[model samples]
Every structure is written in C-alpha cells, then in structure tokens.
Target: MENLELSEGKEGLPYNLLAEKLVLGSILTIPQAIVLASEKLPIEAFYLQSHQIIYKALLLLYAEGKTIDYINLITWLQDNGLLMQIGGTQVLLDLLSQLNQSSNLEEYIALIYEKYIRRALIKLGEEMIESGYLTKIPLETIFTKLERKFFLIAEEKPMKYLVSVEEGLHQILQEIEEGLKLPQVPGLKTTFTDFDFMIQGFQKSDLVIIAGRPSMGKTAFAFTIARNVARNHGMGVIFFSLEMTRQQLLYRLLASEVEIPNTRLRSSKIKRTEWIKINAIINNLSELKFYIDDTPNLSIGEIKLKIKTLGIELSKQIGLVVIDYLQLLEGLKSTDNRVQEISKITRALKKLARELNLPIIVLSQLSRNVESRINKRPMLSDLRESGCISFSLTERTFESILSTRNSILSWNGSSLIREKITHFRITGRKPTYKVQTSLGWSLLISSHHKILTKKGWKRIDKLTLADLICFKLILLSHNKFSITWDKILKITYQDLVPVYDLEISQFSNYLTNHLIIHNSIEQDADIVIMLYRDEYYNKNTVEKDIIEIIVAKHRNGPVGSTKLKFDPKYLRFFNLKDSMKIV
Candidate 1:
C-alpha cells in the first residue's frame, strides 16, 4: 500500500518539467554550461552552435550599434583572450536555449542562475559523496571548484533565435509572387529567339534548363542570358559558375556583349577603343545588379543559403538564378550515387524556383549518343538523366532546338513530329524570315497551327527512303546534320549497273544498302552533284522546298505534322501576302 501511494505520487510530478530537467541534467555538462553563462550572451538559440555565435554577435551589435564593429569584438576578445576559449558562439547559444525555456524573462533568468550555481554544486557534491571526500575534507575545497564553474557561466553570453522557416518562407514568398507579376528584369535576354517569344519573360525564380551537347554553346548561351538579365534589365542576377571563375565568366560576357570576340579576350590584342567600351561596360555593369559565385562543387544547400544571404544584402532584389550547369550541383549531403544526387539537386532547384517564384536557368550536357545520331540535335532522352529533370519540372517545359536546319524532318529526317506547334520549315538566304500565320510566331507550331496555316498545306508527305538518305547527306554537308557514320557513299547507275547488271530486283537491294553516286566524307560533299550529277536517277526539281519537322516530345501536344516551305531559299510565306506562289 505504501509502495503504490509512492508510485502514484511519483507519476503526479509535472512530466514536462521532469523531461526538461532530465535533458538539462544529462547534456549540459557542468564544465560547458559554466563557461557560457559568464560570457553574458544576448540571444537564446543553442541547437546550432554557429547560429548561437551569430545570435551573440548580433546582440553585441544591437547593444552598441555603430560603436562596436566586428573588429572591435575581435579586439575585445584579444584583450580578454578568454574569447578564444569561451567555446565560441555556439556555447552561448546552448546557454540561451536553457535560459529562454521559461515564459517570463525573470523566470528564465532565475532558471539560468539556478542551473549555473545549483547544478554544478549538486554534481560536485555527488562526486564528493562518491569519493568520501565530503566527510574527510573540508567543504571549502569543494566550494572553490563550484565557484569557478559559477564564474564561467556568468561570463558567457546568450544567443537569440533567428527567424524560423515558416516566417522566412512567408516573407520571401510575398516578395517572389509579387516580383513575378511585375515586369521582367530589364536587361536579361535569351539566345533562343523562339524561347524568348514563347516564355514571354524570364521572370524571377523560374528554374530553367539550357541543355545541349558538348559544343552546343551552353556556356555561351548562359553567359548571354546572364549579361542581358543583369546588365540590360538592371536586375540583379546571381550566376553560380561552378566551372568558371568570376574573371573568366566576366571576360566571356564582355567578349560576347560588345562583340569584341572571344579570341581577343584570350590574347592582349584588345584595341584601346575595346578597352574604353569594356571599361564603360564594367562601370555600367557595376550600376546593375549582377553577382557571381565561382565556388566549385557548390551544393544545393549552400546555393540556397547564399542566395538567401544575397537577398538580404542587396535590398533591391534578386531577379534570376543561373546555374552554369545542373550536373555540377552537389546534393544536400554527400551521397554514394551520383544519379540520385543529381535528382536531389534538380528537385531542390525546382522547389526553389517555385518557392522563390523566380526563373532559374540551368545548363546541362546531353548524352554522347547525341553525337552518334544522324541528327546531332538533342532529344529529351538525350538529356543526361532526363528522368530527373523532366519529372522535376511542374509548369511549362520548353526545349529550344537552335539548329541550322529549318524543318523537323531535316532536323532528324522526319523522325520528329509536331505535338502542338506545327513545326515550320525555315530556310532562305535572307538573314531573317517571318512565316506569317494566324497563330503568330509563338503559336505557329502550336496545336492550332493546322487551322492557323492554309488548309492545303495541312497534310505532310513522308519522304521516300532514297529521298531521306539524300536529304541526310545534304544536311550533313551543310553542317545541318550530325551522325555516327564516318564514311558516306554516293553511287551512280553506272557503278550500280555493274553490281545489278540490269536486274530490277537487285536495284532495290542496291538502293537499300550502300548505293550512292559519290564516295567521300558526306559533310563536305556537294549536294547538287549527288542529287543531279547522274541523269538516270535524276528527278526534275521545280522548287527547292524546305520542310520543318518537329521532333520534340511534349507531355501535352498533338504529334506528327511536318510543315513545308516552298522554295524556302527565295519565297516568303504569309497568309495575307499579295501572291501565294511557290518559290
């Protein structure tokens, strides 16, 4: 009966109080806790040690304001010399956590006082009891150690709580959503002519990917966008260039911006006028909001922290975030698998874009298989670990194929199909040509293109095998196509005649296999001779038609409709033109 009543009484003690006491008793070592309280730390968060230091530093700043600088703090520390051994700022934070647990400031202070004085006393008293020193020696010796512990606690300072995640998100989100509605940053531009039209703007916090093969100008394109966004738009852009340093990125930007040429930047051959332009550009750049972090192996966590810090420092705002390339990003923490790490990075970036509500532009490398394909142009599958990139994007996903070839079929011999945008065949000697349709340039290749363009040009003709092969060679020759084949053959009827010897059945095999009129590297082969050099295989050509094929795989767009441009080299197409004649 006595035991049961005792158990009931034990259960009645305040569980929260008990837990707090237990936690405080176990983790807060007497030696560590004593050193902190004595410092007189101002703030109250000790979970993170570095955070504690910042809190204490800020308290010092708040107390003295302009009178006390960081250097002053350091100098004071040097004079005291105790600062170096005060367990740094983190200990101060731990102490603050202990003190701030109480609702009332007085109660909190009392609690800290009790812990500083009483806890150490209890510990020493227990040790003395265990060693029989309490009875054998005088209490004065034990009080000395307790006194030392008390002094350390009194000297340490407290740490303040930084803003919580919820609060930070609330404030940042307001800024982000508002920034999106406003006009885009003044100077940011796009290398992709079509992307600029469709995207309308490169708004803040939007995570964009500029993916391509090794030589597809990923760096060039990113630099162009960064320069325009920062320099032209008067918007602050933070370019995290893991691959290049600030000076290198700046040099390339200057080279591209003023049209001075990259080779000149590499060498000392820059003219005086160039220097004048460069200096003026640099001065202009300084006025604009442009920042760069060339730190290599930057993790997504670090990137987020840096961006947050930047946003705090530059009161104006951060309009855009550009990662030189996506693959360079490390995971939040080191991981065993790179692919998994990449996925994590992409997901974080996408979340950041949505959270920040700003556009983020990232560059990525395509697979080497792209170089082996007849169409050197990149496909979604060609994207390195595209599964992660594709899955991460929630809103609009865009693929800008800036190839010399105008038509989709020509892009990869019609392996591409239009899902929404009626891919146009753009070809001509003119520097620029506008294919007018009701849909406008942005909507020309969109789903409504069939109704937008003339009805007669709606249906697309599949190219015959012979025509396809010949077209491939033409693109390869003009540097419009890329393939794995090292050797291209052009055979004439005379050459094939020896193999077939006038057998009609053998002709199909010859045509299907290696039959060609010319034999050499196809890239430099003359298209006219390969097509019309042999009369027997020649077909009378009335118009040099350029076909536009769309190879993009859109999650939501119609598929398979190749558009044709008649005599694209000369004739321009417009629905309201005076003449609809073919070129």
Candidate 2:
C-alpha cells in the first residue's frame, strides 16, 4: 500500500497529507468520529486524491446510516467503482492502521482544516498574481476581488459550542446588574434626541434598515447618524456610498456642518464669508475618523473586506457601517428572481453585522407601490427583502423652501417688473413678502435680521443690510475689486439698494451710526457671509419640509415614529428642538 506523504508542498506551498490521513483514519476507527470530523473537514480538505475518495466513501456510509468500518467502506467504494482508483482495500487497511486513537479526532480535524485554509490562501495569491498580468480588468478591481477572498478566509470562525440554559441565565443576570448601574444606551447616540430616544441609539450586531421612496431623505438620515457616531463618539465609521462619489458625499457633509446650501456649494456660488466657515469646518472634519468608500456596484463581501482593511488602518474597531440605498448593491451571483437576490444580500449583511459586532445601517428604496397608497409612510413589507430592523422616511410635506426675494435693477422699469414679481409667487407656494419701492425701483432686501423700524432701520450687530450688501459686492467682485468703506457705501445703496432720496453719504452715515463696527466690512466679509447664509439662505421651514424617521422594526426596543427637521438647502436633518434653536 502507498504510504500517505506527511509533508507535501512545492515552492513553499502548504499541504499535510498526514493530517488528512489521521482525520479519515480516526473516522474509520470510530464510526461515530465522522460526525465531528465532517463538521471541520470537508471532502475536498484531503490533500491526497486517494484519501479524498476514501473520505467520500466514509461520508456515503455515514449518510446511509451504515457502519463506516473497513468492510462497509470497501463495499461502498466498490459499489461506486472507485476502489481501484483509490488504491483498493489495502489503502483502507493502511488508513485504519494509522489511527492510534479516535480521541484526537478534533485535533486531527483542526490540523486538516488549517492546512486547507493555507492551501486556499496560496491559491488566492497565485490567482492575484495571474490577475495582475491581465490588462483587461483594472488593477483596483482585481485587488478588491482578491482582498475579499483573502479576508473571507481569514475571518472564518470555528463552530462555537452551544451555551447551556444555566450559563445563559447567568450572563443575562450579569447584564441586568450592569444595566442597572449604567442605564445608558450601550451604542453610539444619534445627534437627534428624539430619534435616539425612540430607538435607544443603534445597537451592536443590529442591522438597521433605512427605507424611503425616491427623493426621500434616506441617505441624509444615514449620513446624519454616521457623522454623529464618528464626530461625537470619536469612533471610526465606514460609509459605503455606492450611489455617490466620495467627493459628492463629502460635499453633502460639509454643507450639513457649515449650514451652506448644497446647490450653492455645488454651483460655486459660495460667498467669501461661507469660505471661512468651510475652512474652519474642513479643519475639524479632517480630524474625524470618518472613512468613505464610493465603490459603485459593491457586494457584501467587498464591503466586509473594506471594513476589515479600514479597521486595521484606523487601529480601532469601526462603530458603524453604512450602506447607502441597498438596491444598488450587486449580488455575488445573478439570479432570475431579484427578490431572492435581495433576500440573500440582506441576510449576508445581517451575518456581517453579527460577525463584526457593529451596527450596520443600510439604506433601501421603498417599492413604487408605496407611492400609490393613500398613506405613503413605508411599512416593514415595503423593504425589498423585508428582514432586519427598518426605519422608513415619508415626506409629510413639500421640500423646504429657502426664499430670498432680492430686487434687481431692471433696465426696462415697466409694469413688467410687477408682473415678474407676481409670476415669482408661483415658484415657492409659501408666504410672499411685501414689495418695497426705492429710487423708482422695487427694492426688496430679503434680510433675516434687517427690520424696517420707526428709527430708519434696526440693524443687528454684524448682520446688517449694509454688511450683507458689502458681502455680496465682495462675492460678485471675485476678489478683483478692493473692498473699501467708500466702495462698500457705493455698492450698498447704488447697486444693491438704490434709494432715490437717500444719498451714498447718507447711507454711509446710517451704517456708521446704527451698525456697531470694530473692523471694516472687508475684514469681516467671510464671517459675515457665512453667518448670513447660515441664518437665512440655508434656513428651512419645518412646516414645509417634514421628514419622518419611522422606526418600523426594532429588535430590542419599541417601534415608533420620530420627526426630524429636514433642510433641503443643506441636505441635512436636525432635531426639532435643535432646529428651532437654529431658526
């Protein structure tokens, strides 16, 4: 009989034929040993082909409820016509002879499984090398695929023993005792107080599903929680925004933090004052442990691999994992049924959450059927796969309106201007401000703080109509025009608000007398612009843009609804009380 090779490898590869023989021999020696060995070692785990055939025979006998002794094994192999191919009954006898005792079956299984994993790693490395030589696929794609394969191998955990009821009760008692002393939610707290109160923050190993129809603030809500966990808790976050690019997601985050309109930021219509806020926010944002991976068409395996890599790089376990809108994720394999694919994806995500011991927030889109319903609030069934804790957002009102009724000097000052103003009323279906006439031209300065009073005008500290006019002049000047007091005085009344009776000198006098100033408007232009934009330009009416964060399913807590003030201008969600403070 041919002896099994103890050491088998070429070019530093890994294989152990002795471990495979010991595993099979132990099962043959003690027929019941196949039960434990099969759990750890599959048929393919055997290094030698002959041992693989022998193990297959043993499994067949075990499956058929037949004894896995040498006689039954030989008969099974002969019946299957694999006896001679596997070196016949002599090889089976040699396997039984090699078994010193079946007591070390687990150890033998462990050795065989370790060798199998090592071989898998070697194969993966070879595939990676071969893939690098191929020019058709991008190097990033190859790296991601290979890295996921490697991580999947590395993250495999051995089967754990089932806990007894007594042990489980002890653990529960301990947890209850600890809970009484702490009483605080164990996971990261969201910035929104009401939402956090409803869900008790995001729990570990929980798969949180945030679903909404198209144009709903699903991504915004996920981002809000991710930002809060990373910034406030100082925990690492891995946000996989498959729908948007990293730069686009960062822009939204910046807009939310600086309270700048996303549209204005995207259009490069930012004021000089807003730039200062951006600079300050960027400095702080740089310190946050927020990582974004915008890999389009990402699979659950790829997300897991990226999270593992990021956790290692950040030197801390990630507190949260966010996948923007689940429908965008590609499955491992294509299937005829999309619902089945989604079900597999969601199950994989849930498994990943438990494996990583972190909260995973996956955004999903509600079905089109949701739109046809009278109450558009999404239900648990609205989720594509409909598993895991889901939170749906139904827009109770229209998008928030941030209106700035500015009066431009029309060259043709006909009744057409009034007609244009009347036409502008249809744009935003909210309240309209009264038109004011100045210098035979309609002057409507939409100031958040500017109030026309009996004493000419009551200008707040730095946010005055004159200051705002100077800020706009600096913005429109594009740093080409030097900002001087005279220049500001001219732009404030001459261009921005051309009052017929009030002279430039009178406007300058009004600013100097009423507005408190330590530095020139030019010196404070950036801060003034940021303050003005944050207060007025990016403001949202709660009555118009109401985003409801409905907790449709909660594993450890009660299910309910929580309303957050959604600011479409900034693409952000805020707690109602906090938003009122901002207003």
Candidate 3:
C-alpha cells in the first residue's frame, strides 16, 4: 500500500497531508467550508482534514450539477476503500448546502481574503520549508502584502445603510407629502383599517414589529404580508419560519393566499373544485418571488449571513424579510438571560434592515400582562424586552411618536381620539376601572364644565338646556353624528315651542356658532358633529354626557374638533352641508 502521510492532530502543526490535497485538488472554496462548519462542527472537530474533504466535494458537485445520493455516495466511498472515513457524507452534505446557498460572491471573496488567504500563504510557506523550493523571507513579504490588501477592502467598503442620508430625507418628505402611498402595484390592500389609514400600506426598509399573544395570527399575518409583497408587488420575499417547517409554512401561505381555509389545506382534503383552485393559485404563485427557510434554532448571525446571501442572489432587490418572532431567535454568542439575547437579536434585525434596504417584519410576543388586562389593546410600552426598538433612530423621537399617535387619533376623530392620544398612567395607583388621558381629564366627563356653572361662575355651556337635550338625542339615536338637524329634531316646530326654551333659530345658531356643526349641500342636507356618546352619561346623573372639542395636533390647521359633526364608522368629521348626501 502506498503510505499516506498523517500527523497527529496537534497544537500548532496542521494535518499537512490534508491541506496539500485540498490546495492541489481545488476542491473546496473558502465560502463553502466556512458555511458548512460555521454551525455544525464542534471546537475540536473543525480540523484541516475534516473541512478540506467537505469543501472539495461540495465545490465539485455544485459546479458540475451532479448529486451524491446517500446510497450511491456510501457505495462509492466503500469502493474507494474509504468507508472508515472520519469526515463522511454528513460533512459533505453541509458543504453542498453552502454551494446551493452561495450569495455575495464579492463578500465571500473579501472574507476569504481576510481570513483564509494569509493562512493559505502561511501554509504555502510551510510547504516551501518542507519541499525546499522557496525561502521563508519571500513568503513573509507576500503574507504582509496580502494582509494589507485584506485590511484595505475592510476599511474602504462601507456597509449599506437602511437609507442613505439624502435618500432618508427624501423618504421622510415623501412619507409626509403622500402620508403613506400604497405600493404602485395594483390590488394590494391592508386588513387593519387603522393601519391602512396610517401607513397606506407597508413600505420598503420598514422594520415593523407585529406582536401579539400566542395564536393571535402572528404567523398568519406575516404569511399574508409576504404573499401580498411577493404576488402583488412582484417583490422577492424571504420568510424565516423558525417555529414551522418549510412545507407547513408553504401550506399556510397557500391557504391564506388562495383562501382555501386552513383546516381543509392541513387535512389534505381537496374537492375537485378546491384542487382546481389550488392548482390555479399555485400557478399564479409560481410567477411570484418568494422563498422560505425552516431552519430551527437559527442564530441571528446565521440569519444575517443568509439574508446577505439572499440580497446578493436577488441582485439587491430583496423587498422584505419576515422573522416569525424575536424571542425564538438565538444570538451567536451565548448569554445568561433571555432579555439580553433578545436585545441582541433586535439590534441585529435593525442592522439587517439597514444593510438590506428592505422592510423587515419581525413578530414578537407581548408579555402575559397583555392578556391580564381587561382590554388587550397594545401600547408601545408593552413591547417585549427592548423598548428602544419601538422608536426609530430619527432625531425627533418624541415628535415622531406624538405625530404617529396624533395621526391615528385624528383619523379616529371621536370621544375615543382624545383617550387614544393621551398617555395613560399605567402606575396601578389609580383605579383600574377609571380611564383618564395623560392630560388628566376623565374620558367619562362631559365636555361642559357644569360644576362651575352651578357655583355661580360665568356659564360656558354655550348651548341652552334644550339644545343640550337635542344634542344628546342626536348622539344616542344614531351611531354617528353625521345626520342632518332636520332628521335629528324629527318633531315639528309646534312640538319644540311648548316644552323647550330653545327656538329653532337659536338652536341653529348654537349648532353653527358655538357647537361648530358643519353641513354639506351637495344633495339633501346632512349634519355631522363630534359629540360625546351616550355611554359617557351615568343615565342616573343630572348632567348628560355631551360633546366636547379638544385639539390634539394639527399640521395643516389649528388642532381641535371645532364642534364639527363626525361619524365614527365613516370617520368623517366635518361641517354640515346641504350637499352632504351619502355616496
């Protein structure tokens, strides 16, 4: 037998024979080896011999499009009398994976030049020493030059930002000018009414956190979003579903996108019609750009590397990334507490968003405290682990928060708007039953300051008692305030004159002047106002719940309701016009 050189795996000396074979065969690319052993190899297992064979086989198979199936691979090795091979087919499989997932060839080259090239040169120097061909002095000079080149690439290349400074300013202006423009792609819409109004729809490079308690459609929502981005916008989307397998995620996506109902899809029960629907939808989906990876217990670094590769493969046209949830993600480095791990994870995600220039939608789990509350509406403070992740890295953090909150409230435009915009005191010192805005006004309180009037202070209840009664009737009779005065009073002038002190003339003036009721004269007359709901009143109390005008924040005009008629459903608060016919 020809003697094969072997060295004991030792402290400083490499397994020279394996390194020589690797360099001579050109079997393994640096990226292939790095990717393969990055996760699986133990500290002691990642030796020169093990990685060498793994890299070479993968490089060959990837380049040639040949496959080494399990049985065939085993038999071939046995025929080569290498059945006892230490770095067997398992190692080779990892190598093949790296090749399949090869993205960022430039980055890989840079990484290789930095990490392995010098080491390769060092190995070459050692070989020179052994072979007695080249001297040690020239090797050192070559190694130094190579090291300089590595640092030059590292220092010169700037990592991509989420938005370039000029582009960021332009984007902010565009967001302000257009509010949130829908993607130019047609037929895409958002399910959440409030979110739709606020964002128009999701934008690229946005790191949106959609968190809820378990089984609150986190995965389902992400799947919906991914489908929308991929199918509608013709944008590439990568979903890293750590909790579910690729097939399971694909099934959920197919069910959601095609409206097959999750149960039918999961049970594999398909009628002829349903199968036709699935086939047609699948064919449509085939035209979309979508990818899924079901790598469980994936670390953040691994995810970043994968995304980087994906960005490269897609020619930097990656539109979105969806991580199922934050807490499930692991960090490359180990930490004692989960909070720290999550903090790291979030930071990495933010970095990934910046790096890839795509919207990264990460699902999160709110604490059980969310469930414990009587109302499960989520607040920004309720965000898990890292509170800072909720805030954007803009110069005006408070301004942006207030602006977004104000926008949501302005669109709501009801008794709820005031309550929604206010920061609630979550201190638990106050009664849980009581609701107050951070501005210290009770949501239950009527707009009029009645106690002062009873104390002989100057009356500020601009409307008389009869007008107040009519306003209450309008608020109670209709779910909205967008009804005309003629519809609201219903009773004739004869009925009003007998019991009430208010005249029709005075009532109209009070509505127009004091209450700020607006009208539309487009067709038949209609009325709209932002009066307090009947729920505000105690029913037993002497004081009735009344509408109040409180300004939040207005960019275009002065902030405040101006006592305009408003509809909670249509969410339109405006002056009554004769033309305010329902469209």
Best by TM-score: 2
Tell me, what's the RMSD of every candidate? 27.2, 27.9, 28.3
Candidate order, lDDT descending? 2, 3, 1
Q: How big is the positional error of residue 55 in model 2, measured in Å on the Cα after superposition?
A: 3.7
lDDT of 3: 0.43
Q: Pick the candidate with the highest lDDT.
A: 2
lDDT agreement with native, every candidate:
0.41, 0.59, 0.43
Model 1, runs deviating above 4 Å: 1-193, 203-205, 386-583
What is the number of backbone collisions in each predicted candidate, taken in the order shown? 57, 2, 24
Instruction: Give the alpha carbon lDDT tens digit for every residue of 152-247 in model 2.
Output: 787554556458999999999998887788547655798778767666677788777777666676677778778889988899998899898998
Cα lDDT for residue 414, model 2?
14
Q: Judge candidate 3 at residue 264 and give its lDDT.
A: 79
- Model 3 earns a TM-score of 0.39
Which parts of model 2 have CA positions greater than 4 angstroms off? 1-5, 9-14, 28-32, 53-102, 132-138, 160-183, 193-198, 268-286, 299-302, 333-344, 372-375, 385-544, 555-561, 574-583
Error (Å) of candidate 2 at residue 49 is 3.3
Residue-by-residue lDDT tens digits, candidate 3, 77-144: 55655545636666544433433223333233233223343444556556545545536557654544
TM-score of each: 0.39, 0.60, 0.39
